[model samples]
Target: MGSGSFSISGSGSGSGSSLVLDGERGELVRAPAVRIGKKGGGKGGLLDEKAMIALRNHSEAERRRRERINSHLSVLRGMISGTDKLDKAALLAEVINHVKLLKTTATEHAKGYTIPSDTDEVTILCEPQPANTTNTSFLIRASICCDDSPELYPELKQSLQNLHARVVRAEISSLSGRVKIVFFIIPERGEGNGEMGRKILVDSVQHALRLALERVNSSMEFIPRDSLLNKRRRVSHFESSSSSS
Candidate 1:
């Protein structure tokens, strides 16, 4: 049969429902008031193949979309989970590792006698605000500290000549002792209002400083050694001298 029909009727004692099977129209009709016997005639309902396929396709699409969203959410969850417990010590350690890597790479490049490129023409400095104030903005400073080499100094000077146009007001201050280098730092007024912007500024400044320090250290050729043993030896010597005195 192409289509079958069925009837749902009330059963005995004004209670219970019965479904009568009709094999002709393939439709199930409901008869709530009439009572039904155990007689086995009528039609069964038609099943629409097109509707079933469309419903299955919709459900599959929804499932795939849900899975994709869940994958992104899982990545975000992992990032936030670690960030939630981030402390000063953890941040310091991360910075130290990064600095060490930069130092190593810079030293390797210097060993090969690689000259500074256009990207290294200007130096960026990020300094935190004084402890007395309640503001959250960092002082982002940019300058050229290449007075030693005339060729490099000219390029650096030209790059940083328009510092006022790029950032907040800049001032040239002589760093105390040794060299005649001037520091061009940002003023407090240009710092933004939010913590996120402040953090970005601080991190940018730190990365720039790390790059400069790496270059300087590469030039100077600094090597790390165990200081604890020297400290212990000094303590022993001081104690022996004190005892003799």
Candidate 2:
């Protein structure tokens, strides 16, 4: 013999009534209906306050998440061209492709071998923003030729970062105990007076980078100490042992 489950089916809210059960016969019983939020259900005003609040909170969180995503996407679009026309999904795909391309480029650049100039010289060129950039930024190239100190690159980069200049690319070549660094940089615009104060920026950056290079060179202890001597020591031609008087 099979036993039947005692499940109650009910409709309509604001009630706690159930059908009378006789064990031997079949009767339909209904459970009490609960409503916490206010809403129209057919002709009756039904409500589910708890569920409503939960749904509202979830919606608010989702809205905020979308806003954050859109804000980041806008920034990315500005950083890369041709992305403004894309939809959300397409924009994300383009960003992925862009990142992959940059990764491959950096890998290719690493294969190049170089030896920077041995002369202790610092050359910095600051290029004004082009027509495409709308005079909003500057492209600066700083090349420093100095003796190879292992800590030079990190210290140099940190110094520039401290000066509000963000490096875009660096070309480093070392050979024969000498090193050369060519840094392509973009200095922050807002750190200046809205538009670039060209001379002020150039002078300040030059001074800062020059100081950094000076510190690195001065701290290095690899230079030879013996330069001038009174006389050259002559090699003795005598085969036999000699006694000094």
Candidate 3:
């Protein structure tokens, strides 16, 4: 019949064309006729077995990497919270301390108390008066035990200027071994009145003081070599001047 080769077995129904089976070899003896409607049935067309396995492995690796990054962020959060640095707790404490220091100093002033004269140490001195003045203000006297150098004066001035407070006046006193800075903070009128104005003034001054200290401490932590050299030069100049005198 057909030109294509076919097999005829012993029990062939008709000798036209017949297919044989090979059970032992697990292979088809004759090619099966292609169905006209069948189009895209294939093993290597879409994604093969190896490709699927690779896709699954890549997805799992990405998931694990994201999990690790999240874990690190959590640890940093815990550390910041525990240390109270740059967090809500530190801010609240700063506000509370400001209020307390102001109240104590005011009370002492109202009672005609004399502030202890220990300029070499850190202290808060207050002088209160009746509400007859034009403006409510805080006269802050800050003293610190640091080197006495002309170069430091400008740095100290710059730091105070950065406070953004309404400064009435600033006085710097360079003693034998330390420097003293005094700031008179006058709260602008219409900000508040009566007790509220006093509170606002006190809070503002305290906040400024805190900022100044933070800056000073930061500067002290990493003093530039050039600044240190200038300081030494000043010290030598001072010594020479004293010896000549």
Candidate 4:
């Protein structure tokens, strides 16, 4: 046999392998490259089958939400008046104003008072002083009617007084609970008799009437001022039983 030498050598078994010293490992081997097609992008890129399904689901949900919102708006538009026009923005504005008016009406009638449908219960009229008359004054006539009570005269008088109004003449009459009053008034001293004055005076009286109604509905007492107390003016009162009395 030939003489064998004790030597250290490393070699791989194939052409692709590396050589190294015996008992020592070779260089690190890299993993093979995985080839991918152009169509197969990442999760955020080209949509796969599962991503397409998810996208369709989201789109459908958004469509349903929009449909629900439109349905509600349609119902609101139907309930409001004067919305026959095709303008959506104008219709929405009308709805807002209508809602405000409804709320005011509801609050005004909260005490079981229903506004009359066929009758005029309140009237405000302003007329210029007669040309022949020497005095420069405008006549403001206001009439209000409700279920008359013994306190109605004092309430009306107090309201007029609060506005510093001078009532030239007033007539009060009642049948059952129906009380009616006609007031002929002029503005206080130094106030104008023009459109501005009339508007202010009318608004004042209207606000006072509203407050009086609230007080009456709640059974609150009306205490006349000391000046009004001494100027005791008798108001005509009528009862249904008066016919027999």
Residue 146 in candidate 2, Cα distance off native in Å:
0.3
Give Cα-based local distance difference scores for all models.
Answer: 0.41, 0.60, 0.46, 0.56
Q: Per-residue lDDT of 1-245 in model 4, one digit per residue for the tens?
A: 11111123333332122221211122332222222324645543333335435544554666667678778778876887557664767777888888899899988875443222323266778777886752446777777766545566577667777885666666565443455576676666666556786788877766776666555545524443443234333445332111111
Question: Which regions of candidate 1 are displaced past 4 Å?
Answer: 1-177, 180-193, 220-245
How close to the true structure is residue 111 of candidate 2, measured as C-alpha lDDT? 62
- For this target, which candidate reaches the highest TM-score against the unseen true structure? 2
TM-score of each: 0.22, 0.40, 0.33, 0.39
Candidate numbers, best lDDT first, in rank order = 2, 4, 3, 1
Cα-based lDDT at residue 179, candidate 2: 67
Name the top lDDT candidate: 2
Pairs of colliding residues, candidate 3: none
lDDT of 3 by residue, 127-241 (tens): 5634675344344344333444454555555655554335555444443444555555444545435676655555655555555555555666566645643543211111110
Candidate 3 global lDDT: 0.46
Candidate 1 local lDDT, 47-114, one digit each (tens): 23343345445546666676786575555446443533555466446556766988999888766322
Which 10 consecutive residues of model 1 have the lowest summed lDDT? 233-242
